[model samples]
Target: MPRRNEDALNFLLERRSVSHKTLTAPVPSRAEIEVILTAGARVPDHKMLEPFRFLVLEDAALNRLGDAVADRARALGLDEDKVAKARFSFDNAPLSIAVVASLKQTDMIPEVEQTLAVGACCTSVLNAALASGWGANWITGWAAFDEPFLQDHLGLAAGEYVAGFMHIGTVRSEPSERKRPDLNAITTWVSS
Candidate 1:
């Protein structure tokens, strides 16, 4: 018989994301961060493509990225408030892992499946951080979809794009449980 991990299941059921603004420094050390990434990289991959990679943003990198965001904001004619808001995301997080999806053209697996694998990597990173006793949240804003921002700031290559940013840090406070999807309503059973 397969043994069940009740605690792991419980943690998933009760998981809550710590807000980006609430996360503080003294984030996961390099050693621990490596472990988190290791866990995250173990997600499913069709044809074992490994079509994803990570870019860690911390300290000076955060400042650089924030400046880039501010520049993009100004170029886009966004008001000061909007620019600040955009920069805040990068400046505030103690550390963030950029899960980048780089899809490859292949006959074996569909490009969409490769992209979905990248999405799974993002979730995997989020879960890994949470499981390792760190506050974590997966986020992506206008900056994520902006090509110039990604290329110039994050140094993403031609096919590379941000799947999600997994913010990791010390948990400031516990968050109240929000509503969950009605599984029964969403789930449909079909039998032949």
Candidate 2:
């Protein structure tokens, strides 16, 4: 007989991501973050290729990121409100973890696999934060897809891209349950 971890399963079933704007201060400490990162690293990797890395943005770094986004938005002739909202994610959140997808040069493991690994890493980080009782959300807006912004600010390589920007902090409000896709409508099972 095998024992099942019901608590972990229950947590997964009921997990909800809190908004970055609704998060307050009292962010996780270095050691606490390390634990979260450790959990984040446990994502599914098809070819054992560690194709992702984390950039921990804290304190003044967040402000710098916000300013960079604003600058990029202005340069691109984007709406001020949109730019401000994008930047606000960093300004308000206590901590932001940038999950970068660094694609490896390999013919055996396709680029898609590496990209999927990066996506998995992002989810892992978000789940880890939520499970740890910290308010967390995975976010990536126009700024994340802006190549010039990424190159100028985060120094992202040509082959690399932003998987997601996960914000973590203490919760300020209780998040309401959102609608989820129906399993029967989305799932298909085949047995031959």
Candidate 3:
């Protein structure tokens, strides 16, 4: 039998994403971030088809990304609030990572499964950041889904799209816990 790690289980039980707005400076160093990204990469890849990649956003890159989002929103004639909100995610974070779901055609793997792998990558990245004593938030806004925004800003390929942006940095305050799902209400069991 494998050994059970109670400490790991406890950490998972208490993990809560910090609010992006409240996440401040002194983000993870490049060396530290490399460690985190490496952890994210160690996930199940169906048929050994690696369907995801990560883009680190820090310092000047954050400004470039935020400005592009802001510009796109303005060009679309979005209202001030919408425009501001669109750029805020990228602008506020001291560091972030774009988890790109870049799927390639493969006969052995279904498209849905590829997407699931990317989604798993997103969670893994977020968890890695949180476990490393950093505040993190998983975010995807209008900019993430907008074709023009993704193309011009993120440079996503024809079939690629963002799984999520993990906003990671120092925390200003401990986040208030939100309501959680009732596991029993959402779960179903069958035995024969």
TM-score per candidate: 0.95, 0.95, 0.95
Deviation of model 1 at 185, angstroms:
1.6
Tell me how candidate 3 scores on lDDT: 0.89
TM-score (C-alpha, index-matched) for candidate 1: 0.95
What would you estimate as the lDDT of candidate 2? Answer: 0.89
lDDT of each: 0.89, 0.89, 0.89
Cα lDDT tens digits, model 2, 1-192, are 989899999998999999888988899999989989988889888778899988999989899998988888888898879888988977887999999888799888998888888888899999999999999999988888788888889998886678899999999999999999899999999997
Model 1, C-alpha of 22: deviation from truth (Å): 0.5
Q: Please, what are the lDDT tens digits per residue for candidate 3 over residues 1-192?
A: 999898888889999999999999998999989989998988888887889988888879888988998888999999999989978888898898999988889789999998898998899999999999999999998887777778877788876778899999999999988999999999999887
Q: Candidate 1 — worst ten consecutive residues by lDDT sum?
A: 152-161
- Candidate 2 at residue 138, lDDT? 94
